[model samples]
Target: MKKFSFLAAPLLLISSLAGAQEGVPSPAPTPAPASQKEEAQTQLVVLETAMGNITLALETERAPVTAANFLRYADEDRFDGTVFYRAMSVDWGEQPNGLLQGGTQNDPKRILDPIAHEPTSETGLSHTKGAISMARMEPGTATGDFSIMLGDQTGLDANPDGETEDVRAGYAVFGHVVDGMDVVRAIFASPTDPYKGEGWMKGQMLADPVEIIDVRRIDSPEGDEAEPAPKETNSAEAP
Candidate 1:
């Protein structure tokens, strides 16, 4: 296993899996009723980037607050003209694994108020391949920045018994890429600037950032307009 470390902003910190502390696992919870076991409501959105379109299905029912926040930005065109400014490549385990970061980059004019931290433990989400998550300096501070994971990154999941805040709270995962992962993979493989970012973010900044032309909700697979189910509670804090 390889270990990675991240500093708070520029973006959220990613802890090294090798250094993760071992603790007693918590007992499993009772299963939800069959009605509640139905798939959560989701919203299909396409991120039209300079490279290509990456489609995402936001889990609004599971991670309501975070999903709604993202929807608001897309609806208002706050993500237009933004760039995928960072790419963190993971060198261990499988090939072609890491994450790409982008968004409003906290542009005061484009970003809205910060939302609450929605740990994966709470939202039942994980930083799996093609997951779309938020980027923030601390819990409850994520605004417009987000990351699209390129591989299974459950290492970023919340550890309730973790030794530190970042580990304990983990990062929120509100959605996953439903299509166009090829576009995401291509962006993750883009060139990076050796001296562009500060501290841990250094060498991870994209040399020629991919521009995010815009983001918008798409019709469901069934060819009907899909409305996000109202979920006021539940998830972020990603790279």
Candidate 2:
């Protein structure tokens, strides 16, 4: 087990914001009526894993291009049969907690062209627990890979004073895991060490990697629509 610290700065800011709002209690703001535009801007994806199904709600309003890119991969069934090959709990000096990384890699060709990054400042989404964000070697190098933060990650978010240099930046956070967090926790608890050079564990590797088995869009009707039409019900008795 490792130790991780709270992201002090951002947490502090959030606390201050909370206090300020509390000090001057404003009238309860009426909920804005839902619109078609809102529905059109968001997408729900389900990642069927060996552990269980993990459902994500992608925020397209805050990250249109990034969200679209991720959904495109899902829609194409590119992530099916992939694995979550890397898990790292960074020792940030407190209770150790971290993220779970996974993506489509069982078929190399499924990997698509790289997409541009959308930082938290741009998307207005924090790197909180269950948030699904891109994984990259460096800024602006994200591709088919993505991860979900299992805990708060203020260090990975934006800061004007270069405080986030060491932490990954410019990686788009387009969605959040709305269900199946327990599955994520199970994956995180899988056996891990230094990976031997071979197979799925090549390059950035994990010793005992968790196999994804398959990753598919669970809710969409497109797959069903593609199936042959069922025999129509007839008013007359079956022959």
Candidate 3:
């Protein structure tokens, strides 16, 4: 198990300048024709961690609400200073498959209200490698936390209860991890253990905590124009 020193200071900081207003969802630009949707779904997001920087392009078409929610948090700066917190890698005979989870700490005001679950039926987004999804104990319980599956995670998308004709629908998948998957794999390989007797842990935890440092939205070219810059003034020298 590789151990990363828990350095409080971040090695790099990537600033996302988009501004998000409360109670106002970011507008979805006009939808592209069917042919263009595939190419247009990609969104770039940079994750500046204590270890290194990881970039991701979220799949908006696959998971609109999930993408919106994530962007909302970034716009609000809710994830600033949060930690990666959870990482797991399954080592079976086959290639390792697991996920990395992170989110805003248990801050009441910062947590966004839960959004409705959009499983494959609604979004057609499968739990494939590099996918990003919300981390919730059960349906309708997701708040600020989210996770990115390192490999196929079809099991997490179905419902656990058999009452529904559909398979056990689990967590709601929102986006995909298009880049920096290596960083995720590294986090999964970090040393971890069950947080003995801790709340919500149920005895499962990461011994060496991975901190998030901060999370902010990557501004689009248009959004970047909205920022206010320092005023430049010319001074005259006395004759």
The ten-residue window of minimal lDDT in model 3 covers: 7-16
Clashes of 2: 1
The candidate that achieves the highest lDDT relative to the unseen native structure: 1
- Summarize candidate 1's per-residue lDDT along 1-239 as a digit string, tens digits: 11234332112344321233332222233344565468889889888888888889998899999999999888777788989887887665476877888888666677677899898887887777888888765578788888888777766677776666776777789999988889988988898999987655669888999999978788863334446334332222121
Off by over 4 Å in 1: 1-37, 221-239
Q: Which of candidates 1 and 3 reaches a greater lDDT?
A: 1
Cα lDDT tens digits, model 2, 137-219, are 44564556777787766555544344334242434678888788888888887777654424323333456666655444444
Give all TM-scores, in the order shown: 0.80, 0.66, 0.67
Instruction: Write candidate 3's Cα lDDT for 85-191 as tens digits.
Output: 66645553235566676776445656767777666545655556787767653446566777777666554444334343223444466666655777888877777
Residue pairs with clashing backbones, model 1: 118-235
lDDT of each: 0.73, 0.57, 0.54
Candidate 3: global Cα-lDDT?
Answer: 0.54
By TM-score, the candidates rank as 1, 3, 2
In candidate 3, stretches whose alpha carbon ends up further than 4 angstroms from where it belongs are 1-37, 159-168, 194-203, 219-239
* lDDT for model 1: 0.73
